[model samples]
Target: MPEQYDAIICGGSFGGLAAAQQIGGRVLIIDRLEIGDGETSASAVPIACLEKMDMTHVIDQVHEEIYLHTRRRTQKLTFFRFCTFNYRQFCEDLFARTGAEFVRARITSARAGRVETTAGTFEAPIVIDSAGWRTAAGKGGEKAARASRKSFGVEARQPYRGEGLHFYVGPSRGSRRFYWAFPAGDHVRAGLATYTGASDLSGDLERFCDDLHLGPPGKVHGGYFTSRLTDAVRDGMFLVGDSAGMCLPVSGEGIRPALVFGQVAGRLAERVRTGEMRLDQALSAYRAFVQSRGKGYRILDRLQSVLNVLPDPLFALFARYIATPRMLRYANRGYWNVASPDLLTADKAADPLPATAVPA
Candidate 1:
């Protein structure tokens, strides 16, 4: 017989770990990597998000301003605070708090209550497909899964010190490319991303660091993330994070949404596990929650499309307009609130779990 668990979570990163937090009983989180081994994101998020995870202690630097650089001008806007953090430490700390069993195995397939992995198959009443865009849950198959991820991003760390989160826009790197340098204490996480799904960005990253005088790039890591929204619940499995295409379009922000949606799915799944709600009930509620944000996602998607086609000078002008104090306030408030802490309280609050790690 296959190993059994109350819940089986695929992909043990932000989404999986967050889902694991809300679930009680024998839970298993499977990933090909050891917890905290793979670092994919730029590793920056709104400070409030870290506070909600109670992992703020892993923060490396706090930023209160954004520095936007264009070929024609540079603008500095202050509206909200963000922080760059130690990714490994954050993951390890959050995983320790989940108290969920973890196994380092690549999930090959997932159905309603069964998941096949390289190591073995596991069954659970509750299964979450937080495995990411490449292996979305359900019977979508590999072709459809690959086609859904339309954007590719790559990032590398370099030895440098900088203030605030810096973004660059212009024709220097490509017609539709943007680069960012987020200061994380003594080193900065610098990266370039294209909306066109270009896979080779190492040379561009090297030149970007050269232009910014940040020295040679350190370790590099990144992968595909979707800007287009997809089904949140598939094959009777709850999907959160990139698997559901929850990454923000123009901003490429995935961490916040992963945590937000993961928390909701986990809480609802817990209700199902406890017999307070049926599986279909939890599925409907989660789907409804994801669909409610469709309008915002569409708006951002449109803006990203516009950015991709705008001329350099025209883009600079547009950036300046948005950086105006009034516009900045409006934009900041709307973006930050997308993954607001208020969502965490949407369900009946569960007491904090003891900080413990189920040995992997």
Candidate 2:
């Protein structure tokens, strides 16, 4: 007999765990790979989520100063607080608390209220696809999401010393993007992101390290940052994180938003399971929440286009101006919050209905 669950979630990552943590009862989390194996994400999430979730202990480093590197000079911006943590471990720990039964399943198909996996079929009234860019939970929808832009980031544990979070913004051979070096105690996450091919990024990353007089990273890691935005809900299926484009355009910060969205989706799933809301009603509610919450990300999408058009010189000048001491305070705060308000606060007004209109 197929196993039954209150909700079946795909991809046991940040967004998936977030949903599981909030959705009580018999929940199942499926993933093809072992948890956190071969994962190289040194994620930086907002301090608010970390504090609320009691995950502040996962933080490996806290950065209050930011250094923006340009062609001519390195502009220093201070007073912005960012915490870098081991995202893989964060997911693992959070998933453990939800008491969700985990299965090793490479999902073959997902429909309105059923999931077929290599291990077995799982049935639920509500299904959530919190999977990352791969969108494994969005099975039977469209093919893999097509990305107009892509990024490759690698992190290595080698000898490095940097007091603040460093971001490199300048000319690359390919599409416009910036490189970042986040110091995480023992190692620094030194990687670049661009709308270019992986091979091109690899070469560029090598040159970037050499130019900075830092040793080359060992065992460089890479993954998709975004696959463009797609529908967030349909037929009792919900997609969060990169699948729903929770990630901001230029900054690509998805952790905080993913947790917030996943929690909302999970709570709605609970309401549906308990008959507080109908399945269609739950889908509508989820769609409305995603649309309203994603407005800021949509704005960032446009800003990325503008940054792409500006010449290297112009971009450098703009960066320098933003980093000036007089503007740094405002810039520091704006940089972290360009997408939306602190989600932990902005999401308190969540009402399951009548806020957004859905197309018929």
Candidate 3:
């Protein structure tokens, strides 16, 4: 007889792994790349997640605020504590805690309770589509061009350091495009992210790096992101992380939200696996959780619109005004209240995990 796990996680990134850990039953995670090699950058995550999971060893530096830059002026946005760490190491560390099986293969097909991969076929009562915006290897597929604000980003490490993370706004190179420089681990990571349209900012990454004076750029890489939040769960398929389109509309910041959705999905997965929650019940809970935040999401959408049309000076003023310590604190706490409620009360000053996981 063929053995089946309770859940099969597609795309072993942060959300997938987080789901697996919380699934609390037999599990298998599949990915296209090896586990330890997929770390990414210009990486910044709320400090609470690191401490919540007891994974702070991955921190490269702790920041008190971020620098928001524009053509006219730079604004200092002092938000809640942010930890810039080796995302790769954090990922590798996360997988270690999951007592689940992991396979390296490309997903050829996927549906509720079943997934086919180059390596073999997997069966389970539930399937999670953490396969990301590009993999589209799972359910509730990514949107079309206009509906989805596609993103391509590339980052290079330089031997420079920043006072704090620097975010360059406006379409320096492309529409819906932006640039960033952050002190990573020990050095710096400079990168550009632009929406897909007439602009091909692939080349602009280097120019932006050069203009920012962040030193010679290293290897360039990129990926796409969906702007709108589609159905979070469908059939017996649940979407987590970028698969759920959790990134901020204009900012494209997903790390922490990925963690949020993953936690919610994982908690639901465990209930489903244990026969405590039915498929529809789980789906409804997840869907309502997502839609509950729709108002907040719309507010961000409107703000992005204003940022796109506002004059340079006004935009700078808005950026500066929002970049203050008070505003930063509000942004951090407020954004999460609706976007990432899982960590609403998570404290980062100390390591606190009522339950446990392993780390790199």
Candidate 4:
């Protein structure tokens, strides 16, 4: 019999590996790295939404306070937000648990039925295009709109200090989007998200470090991220994680969505393999599921342009004001939480951006 697989998942990163581990079928996970050297290894891995998922093994309690810093003000938030990781280690563990064939090869070209990789060609009835970048998948053009979103980050080990996580928001000359700082464990990661375009991220990263009084970044590490807002599934394949453009438009947080959809895709793939579900059924379900979670991202994309159109001073003021208690609560628990289909949909009600808040 020909070498057959129920699913061939490309890109053995978080989502790919997660899906592979969760599914019960003959699986082949293809990745460009030497098993654990891609974005998964380099990620500033932080997983939230644990109340709804089982991550006790992966998550570590964050007893420290959480801080949200605006230009002139800082606020303390609830501790429901947890920080847990071992980015590469967690992924490697997941891979080991999968019991699937692993190929340390790069997928060069892809078609509906077969995929060509640096290692060799593989013929799988279901070809999952979790390849992270654009590729042919029985479809034309990109799976989604290619937004110019990129970010750079640096992580280094140091003594453990119980300082809460800090996120800095400031406009960038390179683009309208600002920078971010995620301080987890011993290392403090600072980076800039250039939504407008890609340029010298190193300087932007340095500036981020400078602003936070974290000078002389040691063992610097940085990377880029893209935002996509469209369907991520095709004929016999589905895209998960960064491949599906699940990155948060405002934050560039991809891990949460990646894992969510990864398990969803894995479950659906099993259904497809059992002939209990058609490919379209699975693809459509994943599309609807992501579109629901992505509602906030869609709204954020709209709000970003509005923020850019405003003057810097005014923009800063708006950011500060939104940090207020009542406003922050509503924004998180109300406006943004609509990403969960179980919650209300932004499309079903009044415009989220208030008329007064929006500049004429």
> Which candidate should be chosen as best, given lDDT against the real structure?
1
Instruction: Rate residue 47 of model 3 by lDDT.
Output: 80
What C-alpha lDDT, on a 0 to 100 scale, does residue 176 get in candidate 2? 64
* Of 2 and 3, the candidate ranking higher by lDDT: 3
Q: Evaluated with TM-score, which candidate comes out highest?
A: 1
What is the alpha-carbon lDDT for the whole of candidate 2? Answer: 0.69
Task: Write candidate 4's Cα lDDT for 39-74 as tens digits.
Answer: 422243333443334433655335344565555666
- Score each candidate by Cα lDDT: 0.83, 0.69, 0.70, 0.58
- Higher-lDDT candidate of 1 and 2: 1
Show pairs that collide, candidate 1: none
Candidate 4 TM-score to native: 0.80
The lDDT-based order of candidates, best leading, equals 1, 3, 2, 4
Count of residue pairs whose backbone atoms collide, per candidate:
0, 0, 3, 0
Model 4: how far residue 71 lies from native, Å: 3.6
TM values, all candidates: 0.93, 0.87, 0.87, 0.80
lDDT of 2 by residue, 1-360 (tens): 888898998878877877777676799999887766536455876666777677777888888877888778787765447778887677777877778898887887776779888998889888888667767644455464434454555555555667778888857444765788888878777777764435346777777777767777677876777724567874458887766766666666777767777776777787887778897887887787677545555666766767756777887787777767877766455455532224432122244332222221
User: Candidate 1: where are CA atoms >4 Å away?
Assistant: 136-140, 146-149, 172-175, 345-360
The parts of candidate 3 lying over 4 Å away from their true place are 1-3, 135-147, 170-176, 196-199, 324-330, 341-360
What is residue 293's positional error in candidate 1, in angstroms? 0.8
